[model samples]
Target: MGVRWILAAGLWLAGCATSPPPSGLPDSLDVSSRHELTEVPFFPQRDYQCGPASLAMTLAWSGLKVTPEDLKPQVYSAKREGSLPPDMIAAARRRGRIAYPVTSTADLLREVAAGHPVIVLQRLESFWQTQWHYAVVIGYDLERREIVLHSGAEERLAMALDAFEQTWKPWGYWGLVTMDPRRLPASAEPKKYVKAVLGLERTQRWQEAEQAYSSALARWPHHLTAWIGLGNSRYALGNLAGAEQAFRSAVRAKPDSGIPYNNLAHVLMEMNRTEEALAVIRQAIRLGGPQISVYKKTLAEIQRRRNS
Candidate 1:
């Protein structure tokens, strides 16, 4: 079926406007400082692949206990595109999970006001100038209407949900993932703590970024990005051994990504491992490295230096 028809059918099946307020709680609790647990009890060892069915199955397998079939009965049969159905939300609530198919920043703020946790899946522009999908949401509030969210890379704080929602709408709104305060995983709690660290790295907030990267590494040892960032930061800070170790770990964790290969090659060259560096550069070329031209130029320079 066509995408629009599928979406319409999903809206109809979900009983869109007819969804009742989530069960088991009144909508009047103060959202700010609501005191939910601050850690994820069971983060998946592998990164969950994107796609509606894949996500549904992963959440189910991760202990939410609801299958794609369960969600299927509530929404359109042909893979509803865009925001999640209200019926799906109701089912999640019944199972003690909070659900919101946020369309705007305002929608996010409203959900936060209702004393329910929020999850937001957004399409964002990546460094490669292509759009990529990411998921985060308001996990808590240390101050009124200033919320915290479980953003990829780290937790984020002091955001006005409405502002955040609106700010992010240029990207598509996929859905939200949430749970009750009591049911939230301890390891996953305080999402802002992690987000803050990643944010600093993005902004070149070097000192703070280093500390944040360290903390996240302590918690999620195999996180590939963290290792890469840690290595890069250490290299910048002149800690060669630390940087080398970090880059090695990153390459081991994700051998296919060309960025780490390129980075490692540069470091190897600096350490006088010219042959090893050339081998790494050749591997990156085979793997479709982003800096193809730069790689070519660097390889030529390396050959000239060796001849000299």
Candidate 2:
């Protein structure tokens, strides 16, 4: 199975249009009938390296100077004869990029129109054979009813929209848009965006996580997790004041959530505001949620500090 085999496999399926346009797409997506991210770089895959190649294109477009070769060790799986989707996601996260999944065709187009190239997995052959292939979708012409891709050995492969869906849908319409943490995908939902940022935070990329958290708050003001993550990241970077401000914002966002109060108490204690810390922890303990035990611990720690 190579590029030729993959292309040949899809030829019979290209002309028979089947999948319908997805419903409930945002009005913002209708702003264009034709759109393309021409600046998105292309890397022709070599053998079972389409995953790395496709990821490289999107990562580079996100302003990172990377190559398929550099990504192979991180994303490729010789045992599986290709890269796993989770591995691809982790690779992007490790590089300080958000690997946001664009599962619907409409959202994929939305991201492309917003100048983001998407990495999509396709089952090139019949469902039985399952010739799984990775490709980058960089453009689409809704007027002409075509999808543009930077496929293997073909920098500009144009397939019919329905044809692309036939190949993509079997894979659960699975696609991903790699982007800077500072930027959110055009079709980002608040919960998904915050989850992606949380994944980035696990990578210990505090700076990028901070940018993403800040961006999340900009879009969805006073999102509780976004504020808490922003505070945590700021604290990691030695910006106690900024962290305190973020925690304060979080406290305002969800006054009943003990999580924010517990975090805010910690930040206040770090700033040597022991009295304020005690007050915050007491509120958290009083209005406790899931972390009641953690709040109790925080109160004890604050008391210990005051006594010393």
Candidate 3:
């Protein structure tokens, strides 16, 4: 299979010293978000009907390929705010598929009201754990006024839509999916693994993050994000050799992406490979990496170091 190369975005290190702890770890390790949950709806449901994996599977089965870049929280938020067209929905429905992307519980209710099968993604907190979980809303019972969903392991359950919405809205009422099995992916396993890795990385659990990323690579070796995360963690841990290999793999995977180029240049500079670093940074600039000023500043510094 051809490698898919994507440029890595510049690492945003604001307040790096105070970065929050990783999510999805044991509660003892969690750092408080300080942000209150004001928007998410809380509902009592026996099961959750739809989730990230299910949505990914449904899309794949429908012949739609969703990349990690496409599912960024920002992208979903944009879709919810009506900034993007519902192309996914229109595309699937054209093939006699039934699915919709819903930004709010109101949207899901509208679909339910129309007697159409709906798949919803909702932000949820497990009552028992108080941990955030993304769930899929699969079906609803009008008589009981309960929204049905597919919880991670619960398979399926129902809850009052209003209560569920109230609890979930705070996390972002972003949800979308297809109703037919034909719309599911050939395998939801890859997407599931990818998410698990990201969850670990975001929470800054380096060891677990590394293991999760490694596991993802075992499944999808060419996964660019996995390589990027692996490279990043290695770099953070001062394993320059390992970091270099991971970044190189990322570049090989997505040659078109400037992110790996920029990152590779940074690593090369750390190793005092000035000439090579200059060349790679130039490539990154050519490929549209950001912070041109910083790059120029680095070039000056490199020249100074060489002259000295």
**The best candidate in terms of TM-score:** 2
The 10-residue segment with the lowest total lDDT in model 1: 1-10
User: Residue pairs in steric clash, candidate 2?
Assistant: none
lDDT pick, better of 1 and 2 = 2
lDDT, candidate 3, 47-67, per-residue tens:
221222344434443445643
Q: Report the candidate with higher TM-score, 1 versus 2.
A: 2
Q: Write the per-residue lDDT of candidate 1 for residues 8-80, one digit (tens) a residue.
A: 0033221111001111223554334533324322121112222233235324533565544455444333343
Model 2 residue 49 distance off true place after TM-score fit, in angstroms: 0.6
Q: Count the backbone clashes (under 3 Å) in each candidate.
A: 20, 0, 37
The reply for model 1, stretches above 4 Å from the true place, is: 1-198, 304-308
For lDDT, the strongest prediction is 2
Task: Please give the distance, in angstroms, between residue 210's alpha carbon in candidate 3 and its true position after superposition.
Answer: 2.0
Clashes of 1: 20
Runs in model 3 deviating more than 4 A are 1-196, 289-301, 304-308
lDDT of 2 by residue, 128-183 (tens): 55467888998999888799999877888999888788888875788899889878
The positional error of residue 82 in candidate 3, measured at the CA in angstroms, is 31
Q: What is the Cα-based TM-score of model 3?
A: 0.40
